[model samples]
Target: MTAPARTSGPVEASPGRLFRHRDFRLLWTGHTVSAVGSNMTAVALPLVAVAVLDATTFQVAVLTAAAWLPWLFAGLPVGAWVDRVRRRPVMIAADLVAAALFASVPAAALLGLLTVGHLLVVALGAGLARVFFETADQVYLPTLLRPEQVPEANARLHATQTASYLVGPGLAGLIAQLVGAVTAVALDALTFLLSALCLRRISAVEARPHRGAGTTSLRREVAAGLRFVVRDPYLRVLTVFGAASNIGLTGYQAVLVVFLVRSAELPAGLVGLLIGLASLGGVVGAALAARLARRLGTARTLLFAGALTGPPALLIPLAGAGARTAWLVLGGMLVSLGVAIGNVVKGSFRQTYTPHRLLGRVTVSMHLLNYGTIPLAALLAGALGAAWGPHGAIRAMTAWLALTPLILLAGPLRRRRDLPTAPS
Candidate 1:
């Protein structure tokens, strides 16, 4: 069965034109609020585990692992399911589930029953919701806008999301310091509900899902998505590179809080402030991504973006108390900036290039490897942190990150000025 055609506005719409798109605005607004909340949890969750529970470095890393473990477990099937439903509803449901799961954390804390075990369960639940929300979102975006407008929309979304990373942690730290980590978490829960409400209000209609003959079989549908990615040169290389980069990125990030608080002797408030300040580069990267792609070509922009993600990571391990902390800001800023640019470009490419019916599955198929490595990386970093120390773990992870950009060189990306507009 052929997928239904979607409505499109002018292909040459201006960058700010998406803001005038009622449904896109709703989606962007909802996503922005949710991103701020999620970033806050990135800081608050670890603080709860480490400060409140007195968790060891390994245990703190385990909390990070638990959050991402669901992608490894349920990602494939969820993708297939998303392909069979209205994406917006799936996204809304995921948001509600996440809200409930996050809300449980504070409720348990107030009952004097907060435990590492409980935190892990909440993390796992929220992660499951994320798997659903993210898969649906990737597919849903294309339905809401013209193909040519995707890069601009992605750039705008990435810009705001990165801006949240700059704001969320600092706010989380201040709130955590004043009230408690639990209170900060409670605030995060409310944000998820707000996101759900915004999603519910969007009136754009989704095309009825096209279920071709073999797609009724979940395993077959999943396999089709996997085969599409594995057989496509662009997706195949991108997936491998993404997986490699994530291993290094997630590995160091798993132990970063421990490194800052324990090894660098920074206060909780300062830790969040530094992370937020460092994330400022991400905002810049996102803002410039479209312009850079236009001038440098998407493929060249990616090569440059990939560079920013790697070598500068070395500066992170150099961070210590006082003046040395500036290294963290510079290093993290560069890494975040690189990641934001790559995300905007890659997201737009994937959305436009993949077959509409297979977008959900292909997106998840790529992420299955890309994000599946995160838990393993977290565990490895934790083990490294336990054996050597937070600094040693950070050094090892950053060193590994420094090498991942080389993976891109092995692919066709090195030969192209722009990614293919559509799969050949």
Candidate 2:
């Protein structure tokens, strides 16, 4: 549980020098392409369900649920497997498999064979690939940079993802509007191909072959990951806080488009524009995250970011039916900023604190908690919106947000200032 040793002096990274590391640059490029593609599908998949297939509230919920199901089902086994193999190959293979899966959509559409079932399959496959890619990236990142460079490396990664949100969804909106949702998905598939190419170019020291009698059985490996997290008071508190926040946010996301279309009475094009504008705040937040972490210390910065992000749900419901749309959009932007900042702090700390060998399991375990509740939240949000209307549902979600931070405040988070510096 002890952190690695550090030098006596403050850790420093050269200005923009992290990018000068060739492997990191390649990894960044690959992820950037994949991120844009992922964002496109995030927008495109729902549109296909709603627009083309004319899916109902519950059906749309199913699409969202399918996207997260892999984390629940495949997280632990995949994490164990990643630890036993070369992470780069896992990442590359994931990209290739994902590309093939995504490409099937446009092909099926062209053949007039597309259906809700086909869409569900694509969601499942893409989610599985995501689990692998993310697990590998978490395990592989420390190998590509020095310990001192982790915060900066993570910041840049966040920035790329945020930039994709800012650009990709808007672009997907336009493409979806012009050509169709399936074709827009083709663009996402191409990004995966690009990611695979980038990953293929990365050279690193692979995990050494397991020579001793492997004592880490799957169940034991999973339990160890769980034990490591539960034993660390900081991680334990953060996990609980994360689970609560995700529940609220996922619930809100499940019903967001419904609110925009039904209550706000906005057109699809206008909705896309509003959502894209809101994501600009994420870009700004990512840019600021490293500086904020350095200034506020990691734990305090994370607590502040979490607290700032959650209450914005109230604004969505409070913007009266008669209020200007601009006000609601501005509030959304602020929420994105807060969430982006929180993610940067948490990701950096997790990467820095966890040992490389355990990274995959720990990362997957964390994700399993963070994302496994999406189905429940999505179902609740959809049903509540249907039964009570979008405004009332949003109000209920705001209540959940209001209560989440209390979980963090009551735990070790209240007194924690910074992640422990590595021992010298």
Candidate 3:
């Protein structure tokens, strides 16, 4: 089920010159714009649930679960489908669908029809669209640039995306503070439309999937992807590590907004400010990732980055009023730094390492486990918060996150300097 590599240009793109690559620019621009919007929703959506709907701790956590639950169910099939179609179209269509879904929230609010149930439905629908969009987005990158250019391109994307994390939350909080959470959500919807327009202008053409007489059936294609990931030691280990880490990451995150607003007594504006400023670490990570990988090797980079992510998460729960908030900011910054570095390295590695045809399926296959745990973790965190209080839940989740890096040591990554370029 592996598809051959396709590129828009014959020559390898020079490092840092992708800005001159028209299609890549368009792709990057669209993705960056949408990322900002998504980050905004990260702040705005929960605020809507908490402020407008007066959702309880468990309910807010459920809202988080609803947004990610689609990955558990729709991921594998959507991956297979993306492999069988033009990825750009899938991406464009996903943006449009998400735009409409998010837009519905504010509309409902205006009519006094908004409910936690309504938010849950919107989250689920938008999550489904994200499943499609992300799968297609991962597969589509290789078609625009050469293998050698992937790390650089990924670095650029990660940098901008991280920048959005820095910008979006603060802006979302300000908008939430000034106008309302619903208005911020409405603005997020418009960003999707803008992303779709940028994507529409890309000129790179994807080769249609060949349907030979012996072409694998859909079920077989899906199975083939699963087999490829399970049998490959590298993919297997990475998938295991990802799934393990996400449980801890999303668990803490599922309860963080509630903890910050309710227990810490931070205003929505200050919470967004704290989060956005802390996300500056991600920008640093994205900037340094390529240089670190070049000097330290990708495998070592992963190990080092993993270290940065885990332990400092403990500081997050130390946060409280006034000057003590610096603990959360510092802790979050360090953790984000690690996560960003890992994302750049892993994203480039996966894009180059996997066969083009299996890219979608394989990407989703890994994500299936990586993200599938999110809802469960959210529920668990919600329950924990209900039982121990938000601060206690934060302590429990961060402790789990701190231990997850050990999972990587069990894999062959410990022995290798660089990840293999392709399947051996």
lDDT of 3 by residue, 1-424 (tens): 8753332211134655778889999999998999999999988999999988899999988988999999999999888888888889999999999999999998998898999999899889999999999999898888888777788898889999999988999999999999999999999999999999999999888888656312668778788789999998878988888887788888888888888898888889988888898888999999889888877878888899989889999898888889999998899899999999999988888888898878888999999999999999999999999999988888998999998888888887888777777787
* Candidate 2 local lDDT, 199-318, one digit each (tens): 888876665635531466878877778788877766777788787887777777777666776677766666666667767778888888878877777767777787767776577665
Tell me which residue pairs clash in candidate 2.
Answer: 5-423, 6-423
Winner of 1 and 3 under lDDT: 1
Per-prediction RMSD in angstroms?
3.4, 2.7, 3.6
Best by lDDT: 1
lDDT of 2 at 214: 43
The reply for model 3, stretches above 4 Å from the true place, is: 1-16, 212-214
Where is model 1 more than 4 Å wrong at Cα?
Answer: 1-12, 213-215
Measured on C-alpha atoms, candidate 1 has an lDDT of 0.90
Off by more than 4 A, model 2: 1-12, 207-215, 318-323, 422-424
